[model samples]
Target: MQKTLSTLTNNWAPSSLSQKVFLAQQVREHEAAAAQPCGFSMYMLMQRAGRGVFGHLKATYPYAHNILVLVGVGNNAGDGYVVATLAKSFGWQVTVAALNPHKVLSGDADTAQQAWIAEGGTIRPWQDIDFKNFDVIVDGILGTGLKGQVRKDASELICALNKTDLPVLSIDVPSGLDSDTGVPLGICVHADCTVTLVAKKQGMHTGQGKTYTGKLIYDDLDIALTFNKIAQPSAYLVSYDQLPKLEKRQANAHKGNFGRLLTLGANAGMPGSLRLTSEAALRTGAALVRAYCHTDSRLSISIGRPELMLTSDGLSAQLAWSTCLAIGPGLGTDKWATKLFNETMAHIESEQKTCVIDADGLNLLAESQHAFSTIFSPKHCVITPHPGEAARLLGCDVPDIEQDRLKAAQSLAKHYNAVCVLKGAGSIISNGEQSWICTDGNPGMATAGMGDTLTGIIAALLAQGMSATDAALYGVCLHGAAADIIAQQYGQRGMLASDLFEPLRVLVNPT
Candidate 1:
């Protein structure tokens, strides 16, 4: 089964996720700062946090009679203790597994442990219990403080937990997860759901974070508003709701009222990629859509999709006539591709026309980095690159790119002087100074031709008179939203790029 968190209800999503995402350290520092102003002690905050977890557990897993709580040395264990204590009072079977020796617990965690004991709750060593006895596992072993590889014993326990099919609810951040990077240190708990406190950690929404953190539920512990005031967010998560709708057209509007766009690709043998892109532009309501392809591929492209105005002659002329240019779909990195890439760059530089770059087009640009420095401008260009392409553009490995996707995207924007779209789980749209994270897309979108389709959407939006920033922002959201609609209908297993075309039409013309 695909590892995805099903959006069960509107309640599954946090009502206030639009606020900036804080890093693991930021949440810790800010929570303390925010709590001190109200004279709230760590112990008091722990009580509120534990109560929050207990409330959510009762609401979500009402039928669960046996709960296995994993306790650590940190205050995260305190939250687990509170949950166990409450569960015992509710007359449910509760077992506390102490992954860390209970004697090491101090401060608020010690107080929490004493409270659990006061309620007749006994702690068991990690190895002493059989996991099958429990219906649910409460992971509170590690929080955001984890770094490096997980210890051997904890790693074994995590692996053992993964072997079982029981639903695991993680407290704070999952144990063995790098709350800053969303990457597992060496081993990480694969949670069925994660209850984050204070604010959502920025890492939990990107990279491997999504796979590890299932249905993400946030509890501010009632300190979010005050905490957010003192701790500036690392980045803001953006949604389509925050975007402005496209202005309606007049009754007398014609093709010219929208925008004309020229798509350059379909070099030799590759007609499908350019066709998907050109048709996507048409679907997005671009008035006049044209495709410039190799002489060999031109006939198939024309016969396959007559809606596009196909041309082999006047490459520079087409670039000048069109209001926006989308290049790189099926664009191979050969001498012929180089000629076209250079010519398109020259035209955009001279005319200052808006442009979108994707696929092998990014590869060609990566090859001539120094030459592009003089020509590329952020005001008119947007480059979409998946992780592999982004690595090439940034001259780093894919892991380096994934290690910090937000930074990679922002770096690409700054380095290329263009709006950069580092496409992945939470596609980051950046123009260096400002950034927005799109959280709409699903894992099924990991298909071929997806990037090509995105290029067409962004270019079409730009042609329709949106600013480069707005075009990039709206285009990414629209593309993802359309994909989501298709995933829902077709079950995402055999989803094709064309599945998004009809949905794109309906979404872009939002009434």
Candidate 2:
């Protein structure tokens, strides 16, 4: 059951997430400052921002006969005023549909509003109009300043807009997407394309942000600002440039120089599972990869990849010689599997060894807190669990894991006193302190044996001297990075775990 949850990763992926990070507001601020005028007046910047948005609209909806701008009572609404005025000048029927008619708008927004009205553009209350009648809807209903869930008038309008099927051009993120977590704060606007201004917002890429952003466009309003004053982002969406490069091995090195890897899993029909794990380990550059799984499983295991060694069970003393042990690829929940699981746990408890536990191994551990409560140091342990397995380990639900992935991973690391890899579409690795999100991987790699591949990658990293936490982060980052290459070669829908081996092999050769 724990292993089945690993496959759920297939549906949880977001497309090209790193590009979403470029939508951050911080970058938007930098762009504005580039075209700063002498005095740097706020109104002047707003004017440029309005013009920039109008420019994009012209290019996006050039054939539109009518353009309807939804306005609020803030700076976001002011941008709408600018868009309406620009479109009106081109003979496009423009309307400023004010969501909050009674609220007085001020600052640059107020000025922009009066100018649009003076120029013969009609400003009408939103209550008087239906969204379905609009040719194009410019959503200026919310801004980055919004916090908490949206409700009431704004929520109703967002709902109405979604039903219109109009090509919406959003300004600075889809209204309800969180600037940090990428989760929606209640109801959110669905945009056909979002033209974010000034700085990029974090929410546009991670979590559920991609769906809301649509065809995202960037607009830097040319304002003067200092990045030093703005705090650095707490997290990052991994990109190709951010991935660690793999180096070619030195000519003098041999198979022994890489590091020996030992694994235990595979029972009967599940040999494909352990076989996949071993192959990933070997392909990932493990010096000498070996496995202890069901003997009958060897029919397919040694067919092509003769490098793998098979056995029914492992010698108790063999733990001393192995650099890292990967456990639970397909260790089915049978009586013998339990005995093997206990024996593996015994080795981990008595010796200072590096090991990764997945699948049934995790289930067995969840059966009794006493098994996890053993007095072994947490430094050598890495626990990789999908949502359900994680839920069982933490005594919670799947929603709890998705609600705050950082919190769940960190909490698990702190409780278990080991690195926890919360396996999912934005796989998180944490040691109760420094945590990282792996931006690599695509929907194609979501097929069977994917998590096993990850287990092998991390174990290989550990065998080569990466600490439990570093190995976990590096492994996660590298695994996803490799999957990204596969995704690019084969379309996202058809990418496979085996396709990642070549990229993984290249990434870890040296550097």
Clash count, candidate 1 = 0
In the range 1-511, model 2's lDDT, one tens digit per residue, is 1110011121122233232343245554554344444455667767777788888888898878687799888888888888888888878888788888778888889998988989987778887887777788999888776768886889888888888878999877677766665677898887899887765565564446666788767664543234322324434455334544444555576776766778888887788777777888787767688888777787867788877876665457556667678888898888878878787777777776788888877787777556464534456789999878888888989877766666687788888778899887677676766556666666566688889888998888777666686567667777887888877776778666777889887776554
Number of clashes in model 2?
15
RMSD of each: 5.7, 6.7
In candidate 1, list every pair of residues with a backbone clash: none
Residue-level lDDT of model 1, residues 1-511, one tens digit each, is 2111111111112235345687888877778878877777878888888888888887778889899999888888888998899888988899999886646677888899999999988888988989988889999888888767998878988998888889999998888888777888999999988998988787788878889999888898877667867876667776665565666666677787667899999889998899888988888878799999988898888886667899888887888788889999988988889999999988888888889999989999888845665577777889999999999998989999988888888899998899898899889888887777788888888898888888888888777776677788878988888888988988777778888999898887759
**The candidate that achieves the highest lDDT relative to the unseen native structure:** 1
- Candidate 1, residue 484: Cα displacement in angstroms equals 1.4
Each candidate's number of clashing pairs is 0, 15
The C-alpha lDDT values of all candidates are 0.83, 0.73
Q: State which candidate has the highest TM-score.
A: 1
